[model samples]
Target: MSPANPVAGDERRRLVEDVIQRRILSTELRPGQRVNESRLAEELVVSRTPVREALLRLEGQGWVLFDHGRGFVVTPLSTDEIRETYPIVAQLEQLALTSTGPALRGLAPVLSEINGEFGASTDPARSHDLDARFHRTLASRCGNGRLIALLDRHWQALHRYERFYMTHPDDHRRSVRQHDAIVAAIASGDVASAADQLVDNIIGPMHVLLERLR
Candidate 1:
């Protein structure tokens, strides 16, 4: 029997979703930036239908807002939103680590790979991608699809701030050191220490970003 085709309409939708998400997260598509359907369709090399579908999905996720007559625009990252969301994210991430403590041994190779990537990366964008992948891998192991989905949504919302930090030279170095610490804690099976490191790593950058914004 032939292997099943992996690229289906669902795959197209996911691709479109990723394109819109990357643009928004990278701030290439900034807050209040209007999404032109035809232009995005051309840029993404997809039909307008898929682009529209992706925008609708983002709208539902609070990453985009549609006005009655204004169509869709990237949502602004309000200080209040960050204040409310980061704490919940911290709790969820800690819970995931605590729940998955037993399986963390399997994650050593992945952690090592991430460490190597972070150590070798000099480009801001590449470094941020590896950092995101490392955290997402950990969260995915929580084995709760709902929790993963929730965290994914929050991460999308927080990506703008993350990108800012990733591009800043000092913050980038500190971030790598923090990730190194978390990896060490996890590798040593110190769940409490890992959880503490996770919270500090997330909240520390967030606090700095908020202060800078203010």
Candidate 2:
């Protein structure tokens, strides 16, 4: 028999990983749920090998954990995760903003436009997406690719938490107000103030999220 194609195998594994990660982010696969490799393989219409590979990848990314007796399980939600993840993201984003130097002012108009859309969005999911785009645009002018990449990694980990919080209209409104402050600071060329406001924007919701988890 011919050997399996490595390229095809890799694509299948990535496809499986994307589908499983999306489910986890969307909370379709709730925290602490057991991940059935065989069942997922059948559902995804792929073989067990790719499913196993994908689960291992997800494990590395902190989306799931491996257990000898129980197999893979979704990583449970915890206040500790929030405490650790939020500050790192806040600091990284602040550094990214400061690194933009004189060019940060140029991004204010774009940032304001995105924030306006985010405020008008009524759907939690839509709001979450727009909020992410607003942040991405805020940091777009920063020349440090490595900082952005690291920020994105931790930022993705916050998605489940952020998405959960977006359902509360009051909390989201606070975020919109914070975004406005950050934009105003940027437009005025007050890098220090903008960085402070940006940190507030990133870390403020964290308090509410932690309280909810507790």
Model 1: CA > 4 A from native: 1-15, 42-47
TM-score of 1: 0.82
lDDT of 2 by residue, 89-181 (tens): 989988889999888898999999999999999998899999999988877889999988998899888888988889999999999999999
Which candidate should be chosen as best, given lDDT against the real structure?
2
lDDT of 2 at 22: 79
How would you encode candidate 1's per-residue C-alpha lDDT over 1-214 as one tens digit per residue?
9875556656777888888888887788898888888888887677777788888898887878997687899888788877888888889888888888579757867886886788678887888888888888877687888888888888877777777778877887787788788888888888888889889988888798788779
Cα displacement (angstroms), candidate 2, residue 67, comes to 2.2
RMSD of 2: 1.6
